[model samples]
Target: MDGTSQSQPQPPEQTPTSLSPSAQLDLAITLALHNWPVLSLAVQSSWGGPTSADKRDWLCAAIAELFTDRPDTDAGDLEEVLLQVMNDEFDVVVDDESAGDVADRIIDLKGKIDKGDLEMVNKLWEDWKQREGKASSVGLFKRVETNDEDQETDEDEEEDGEDEDVEMEDAPATRPPREVIEPEVDEDGFTKVVGRRKR
Candidate 1:
């Protein structure tokens, strides 16, 4: 060690205290969206057109704006917005009831933020940063299909106690199989490959 060497001061630990209430709310919304498995799958699979990623960013801003514009917004209102967005933007009808849970979490976070408590927001931010860009292990949901014919058949089977030995099978897939489109060449001779659902 040199005699004239001096120790450098370490930076202070980062905290959410420096963020404004609106910004904190925005962060909470973003993190909430990130943790949503349905939205994650839609974005990963590009269900919302070619700009699915951009749509997610737009959703975060829109949600934050909703809270700002209407302070009385509750979990129900949030859930409606989430459901509409999924349907309109990603062509996804969310029947798993996870939207309500996500809305509740966001509403709870906003309430805490209103009271100047940022602990939850900070923890979520830290967790998101730690796992950014990583594939989520959360299991995806499957859509249930039902019809009058199937229901009548099920009832007839149940009446005779003939359904007892039926083994449960895997749920039907939620999405159609994607087929890669033929590569197209641009004026600059660049090739673009696109994936679309097989009809």
Candidate 2:
């Protein structure tokens, strides 16, 4: 046996004032929102903007990336942090069910984004916003079609109101189907369709 025993090295002491996961997440979200233009855009896109769901998806991905390099991080812990920070930062109330879905999407998008070119993420967001803006406005420019035959039938019924027994010979013969009416463009650049005429 050796006369002198070897001593093990001491581990570094951890500070007692370290931030909790929620606090850390809060700080991260705050910084990103303020300093990162893309994150701010992502947050804005979440509010009924184009590719809203996709933006949310990317946001979760970015959040996942934030903690991926940290030690002792778990999916559930990350999700809890995400839900708390998102609720606080976005000023929106989300139910537990939706939080779970958001967490799942975050994990999935993180994996996909990891495998692809990160630069494309911003481009994708911009393109989606433009495309969705135009597509969503389609309803404003498009016109709804009405069946002319139905309208004509309605008119005839009104003309024969109380004379259900009117002589068939005296009554005008059934007319051919009315011409298909096209929508007229107004001066305001909107399509104007004639509404059903009242009796």
Best by TM-score: 1
Give lDDT per model, in order: 0.71, 0.42
Off by over 4 Å in 2: 1-65, 71-74, 90-92, 116-127, 130-199
- The runs of at least 3 residues in candidate 1 whose Cα sits more than 4 Å from the true structure, single-residue gaps closed, are 1-14, 133-199
Please give the RMSD to the true structure for each candidate, in Å.
21.0, 28.7
Query: What TM-score does model 1 achieve against the real structure?
Result: 0.61
lDDT of 2 by residue, 53-95 (tens): 3334444334534564463555576667656655544434455
Q: Could you tell me every candidate's TM-score relative to the true structure? A: 0.61, 0.28
Model 2: how far residue 90 lies from native, Å: 4.5
Task: Give the clashing pairs for model 1.
Answer: none
Top candidate on lDDT is: 1
Error of 2 at 106 (Å): 1.9
* Residue 88, model 1, lDDT: 76
